[model samples]
Target chain A: MSQQKILSRPSVGAFMSKYGIVVIFVGLCIILSIMSPVFLSMRNITNVIRQVSIIGIVSMGVTFAIITTGIDLSSGSMIALISVVVATLSQNAMNPDQPVSIVMPIAIAVAISLLLGIILGAVNGTLTAFGKIPPFIATLGMMTVARGAAALYTRGRPVGDLKETFTFIGTGSIFGIPLPIWIYLAMGILAHILLSKTKFGRHVFAIGGNEQAARICGINVEKTLVKVYAFAGFLTAVSAILLTARTSAGNPTYGLSYELDAIASTVIGGTSLSGGVGSIPFCVIGALIIGVLNNGMDLMGVNAYWQQIAKGVIIVAAVLIDARKQKRG
Target chain B: MKKTVLVLVAMCMLILPTAIFANGQQEDGKILIGAAMSSFSDKGQTYLQDGVREFDAENDDVEVLMTDAKDDAAVQLNQIETLLVKGVDAIFIVPVDISALKPVFKKCKEDGVKVVIGNRMPAEELWGEFDVYTGSESIQAGILQAEWVAEAMQPEGGKVGIIMGPLGHEAARMRTEGNKQIFAKYDNIEIVMDAEGKWDRAKGMQIAENWIQSGANLDAVLCNNDEMAIGALLAAEGANLADDAIIIAGVDATPDALEYLGAGLDVTVFQNMNAQGYNGAIAAYKLAKGESVEKWDWIPFETVTPENMSEYK
Candidate 1:
């Protein structure tokens, strides 16, 4: 046992230093499971994963944005806006009276969301890069504009009557694994690849670490920031699609307060709020931590007000740990 | 330069018509009723508009002008001012904030326009000051749901959870209080948790799912609204406990809740919002006609479950 401990010590230390958020998440899961028998059950675990998937996907994009010293508060509102567009297009494509196959609606939704992401991201990018608005103010304005546009688009009514196949992305699972979880996993893998292997990823970190230094080294700082925000927009659109599918309805108010959750997850995952550091996997773990807390608290019969208090406490604790790590470095 | 000119022209086009209409309609014999709506999209607005239209179709002399406050108390105050300037004969307000609108009501009283408060209660003094007060009893909504759960559970009650809206909102407080009162009588009925969903479905689902996962062994859930109840049902379904048949009850007989009832998944209390609107309009018209309107009016409520779900269908 001593020999085993010695052998594991280096990797364990490396993990704690490198992926401390994941370790903390694993610890939280263990504690929750021990405290509530239902937490260990397959059904409850699946439910938790499904619940976390949309936020997880959005957090992944936020991870990218934070790496470049930028933020995207408009993500939640973007989701609402894109979801309305998808819902409208899907409904029109699959008119109940003359119902087309579900594939058409799904395709339309995907296309529209992607296009919207590009256009909205470009707008955000232009404002931050050329218009010279601070990231927070730029994104804050975008957030309100997007949300208001969504509400206006739907005229304050929910857009419903979606095709079954479209809803499947949100509601269905393959081999007992929910589709949203799978989508989140796919996005995570893609993000990991981009961050670890791509030149753009290098540009993001370099610009975040020191924009002037990066520009002195011949990096196009403006372009990189634009790309980062644009990518965030794309991810927001994807999250919106998934949310719409899950609910089977799209209301203008759908993504209210979601931005806070994304930011919280990013921060909890050890992403430096000051920028220049973050990992997709760590962010995923952070989201899972939140998901498990929500699930466990419910299972324990914690009141709603107390659940919010507990969430706030956990976020503060995570931020404190991050601050301590920064001080040590 | 051309673009700027076009923009200016467009702005003027949008503003001109409303300005013209406001100046044109000022007749003494005309019965003008001003409606302050919470929002144009809410069920309240739909019911209120339907009621006004019905009144207009029946009575030729009454012309109803409506403005949506968009759930902003300040905006609602502005709307009241606009109505007052139009010299409306009677004002029917679904106040965005009961207290904030009190001043508007007082001003209307000073202006000598009869005020009819709809779907919400003002302060006691305002109730006496207003011509008619019409709304459903929010406490009764909670009591009715609790009573149903008590009867369903019978001599041996079970664990109950409540998914509420924002704390201190009149409806949320009243419903919660009513439920507390009814549940207090049954020693076996223990409330395990009460969480605010803030009138959000996703939050409600998350709260319900978390509770179920914690092994709380909840036998029933009472939600402040149908949206939260549906959220609880979805959470239960996700947890594969839909088969467990945990009784879920909610206020608001929304179409979705009615459908859930038809599917045998949930029960709901129908507040008859349409009747509230219909009556509010009638009261407004009566006060406008120089007739004495009742000080308070109550609309009927009904309990809907799978047994009588077919009737709603």
Candidate 2:
């Protein structure tokens, strides 16, 4: 009898550890739907998902960083910088006689932005991993630097008048779904595979689980840290591209304080700030919860001030629950 | 010995600059005017600067020194202090926070420097403290926006949704209050919701999307700023709502907002930011010349529609 009881205890704990946040998300949906008749409609659901995708892609990258026992404050500023660069390039400034093909500009813009993100991420990683700066401080410095660069690049002016094809990526739908939503899902899948199936992913968890121990076990800590930040950079680039496309204009001030949302989603997704304990799928769920909360409150006509208070309470509750689960484990 | 030399070098670095700065201010025979700007990033502020520059170029006897506060009141205080030290004859300020600038304004008074306040009014009463206040009333902007919306709705009152700017901001508060006052006058008009968009395009769009999804009987969405107005328009378009299904109006006839107005959005109100700067410079010049300064210089807010769009543009 004691043996059976012990076996059941582990199973129960396992179930709770894996499904706690999911339960809360489901509960929120139920309550919100009960309160608002239109909350559960297909259109609303699609809207919520579409809305979450931008930050959702961001959280996926943040999940990787957090799982490696690091934080990134620069992602928001980096996204803003990328948005302007992409928008400026995508604008047919030349006003070609026949209207140049949209494909070339988009491809060029994506390549340049991705390169910029990777370089910035690499710089951040080098500072933290080699220069002995803490991840928080390193990313914070990069945050200011990146934002300044963005402002300087465009001289604080917003770039608009984007070509039709460029905007299509943001506004277009394939098979009745927004393109951003698809990119977000694809990015999520890629992140999951990286975290679950790749050696780099394994090294990341190892480093995050215990850096000293990871070093003892022949793991290249510096290299893994670099890869982790670079991966985050790639994700930030994807989000920036999508955001620029959606807005059809890029301003230096776009994506202000977005890192807070990305971090919030990661923590709410049941990821510990201490690292080594997050999944991309859970992070997406966390993003969805936030999106749903904001959307649901709007639908219910809740006051904006009250919505802010509720959001803060939910974030605190989520973190507390996560802390408790970790303690129990 | 080495430490002593280092200290002397540092002392000289500091003292020499101040000595030179004092000489520079006194040596010039021209009238010195300093304009502390709130921010230069936005189009409104840029236009305001254009007016300031034009005034400087036109007046050979007056030299205007400009500093951008970048939305920080502390920075504005420092800039004002710098201008005071430079012994400017007069000062023009488009303050970010009026209350935070109280001490600086007092100091300007003690120093006998003429002060012209523009765009944002000081927190305290300005009857004796300031020479002239040049800006439109925030509440007036809101009233103008509502009047346009009311005219569009005509005979029957309709449901209205409000997308406010940053909560607790003076402009946002006054505008919302103005909207409430005007909205209450019409028995047929009802305010269904007032949500904060924090003066952002994305947040405004998200709020409008939720309101639309709620299936509320909304006749119009009024925004505190043009950005939010554009956001609401985007959400409405995304939902495939007809153009006439909802009337949209915003304050500030920004370039983008003008485009939207031209493209068929209902209304926008022009605050004449350039005029405020232009008149503010002229006020400071007259005050520096020891002329009797007016107490208030009110810039009127005009409604912009498709028909009147060309004039504003």
Listed models, DockQ each:
0.43, 0.60
Query: Which 10 residues in a row give candidate 1 chain B its minimum summed lDDT?
Result: B20-29
- Tell me, by DockQ, which candidate is best: 2
The CAPRI-style docking tier of model 1 reads acceptable
Residue pairs with clashing backbones, model 2: none
lDDT, candidate 1, B83-172, per-residue tens: 887767778888888788767777877877888777765756556667887888888889998899878887768999999988878888
Model 1, position A45: C-alpha lDDT score: 79
Candidate 2, which CAPRI tier?
Answer: medium
Off by over 4 Å in 1: A1-20, A89-104, A213-218, B1-30, B41-65, B85-87, B123-129, B242-244, B310-313
**Over all chains combined, what TM-score does candidate 2 have?**
0.93
lDDT of 1 at A68: 79
lDDT of 2 by residue, B1-313 (tens): 9999999999998767556644224355688889999887654677787788899999988899999888889999999999987878889999888778889889987878889999876665655678899988999989989987987788988899999988888888888888889988898998988899987777788889899999996899999998888788888888999899899888898877887885537899899988999999999988888898778999999988999889987
True contacts kept of 2: 0.46
Candidate 2 residue-wise lDDT at A252:
75
Residue-level lDDT of model 1, residues A69-107, one tens digit each, is 888788888888888788776663444422121335468
In order, the Cα lDDT scores of the candidates are 0.78, 0.84
Best model per TM-score? 2
